[model samples]
Target: MDAYTQPRGKPHVHLVVGGGGLKVTDQAGAEKFGDLPWKTDLDWIRERSEVTVSRLAELFGVTRKAFYGWVEGANPRKGGSQVRIAALRAVLATLPSDLHRTAFFGLVDVNFTGDASFREVFQGPVDDASYQDRLNAKLAEINPEIESTVKRLHRASPSSRAFESEYPSA
Candidate 1:
């Protein structure tokens, strides 16, 4: 979908780079730098996640040149494969803001036995159940009350008809 278009039904991730620096927003226009467990500002993730370009390149599974291009504001959706882009987005979503820079860098760099990289871990077959489970676990850890409230709000959200009637599709 185009930048201005919103996905049908539930909220969708939206990434944009502007004067405010790179910002990730949901369909509700809520600014979500990152999600649970690994929340951090997009600028920090882009500039400080890795000590060097090569390391960042390895994490994203892209060439140093390409990584530089992305750093210079290349759109992953337009310049990279969809699966890779999706994996990158998912990995970024979990970066905790409170995580130590060194620790966060190390976490993404050290490829575990089966996992190749943070991107690789989420690059498997399209299965959101496992992702959701991880998110839920992190949410519980961070703030169970907020998690419960969000669930309640989601459950109480307007139906598709009601939503459509309120905000007609463009």
Candidate 2:
């Protein structure tokens, strides 16, 4: 007989993920939940029902391949365990102007969401024309100083084309 001959039937293993609360058919099945148990052959989990493959896989470092294989399945899955998305926009709005990284993340969040606050502050409420007019009046109070600064910047700087070319993004 060939030294590398295969065993009779494949090992009797069943993989269950996420605390072994349920039964899984393959390593791939367990992988969706990021759990990979390779302890028993298909027989034990299905036939004997004594020692759960979930508990026995601990003896072997099998979670990697087994779980990842399931992850690669056509309908691979994932389980939630502390995977959090930051509420960056809300947090960033409150940050000081000097903290630019927060500003970047905040901007990203704002871009990610159709945030009403930003739209309200920037575009003004479409339904509230009077409020917009009031806002424009307040903005006008800050205009003279802004105009003077713009004029000063123009006077001190290079040509508009050159400036545009220098900082095309702005």
Candidate 3:
């Protein structure tokens, strides 16, 4: 039988092609790809933001092929660089769950230019300063206090931040 077909009395099998060549694994193993650390985060971001692979690719400045490959168990680092991953995480964190999708679309459409969607707040190819300013502006609309706190933290010295002092050295 072909790799796609299950043999009689056999557990479900799946074929995955990777750097090591073709791999055959049970159904559980196949699904484990979805359980990768970055996959979990990516899934959460996709669900929360109602984003598609195309949109996410644009946001992370990656090609759609790379993005979908990552979703299908390819190395996430191959999909986006470390800096891009960190920026994506930061932008996702700043998004308020309370912000309605319709409202977000309307706001982004009016205030931004060039692919002016909620994705614009997180996606990059632009300078860091411009990206951050856009993100801050979006956050300000959803929750001014959060925006203020973010600015305060950004302006604070590293030594003055709570995380620096919260834990004592062993």
State TM-scores per candidate: 0.36, 0.21, 0.43
In terms of lDDT, which candidate is stronger, 2 or 3? 3
Q: What would the per-residue lDDT of candidate 2 be over residues 1-170, giving only the tens digit for each residue?
A: 57578566654556544332345565445444333222222222223222333422221223544433432331213321111001112222333332232222223213222333322333333344454444344334434444455456557867658877878884
| Tens-digit lDDT track of model 3 for 60-112 | 66788777666656665542344455555566665655243323433443433
Quote the positional error of residue 8 for candidate 3 in Å: 18
Comparing 1 and 3 on lDDT, the stronger one: 3
Candidate 2: worst 10 consecutive residues by lDDT?
Answer: 80-89
Best by lDDT: 3
Question: What lDDT does each candidate get?
Answer: 0.48, 0.34, 0.58
- RMSD to the true structure for each prediction, in A, is 18.6, 20.3, 12.4
Task: Give candidate 3's error at residue 10 in angstroms.
Answer: 14
lDDT of 1 by residue, 1-170 (tens): 78678556665867766423566767655443223221222244565444676765675566876655455444443333334444444444564443333344545433444525444443344344565444334333434333444456567867678878889989
Q: By how many angstroms RMSD does model 3 differ from the true structure?
A: 12.4
**In model 3, what are the clashing residue pairs, if there are any?**
59-123
TM-score of 2: 0.21
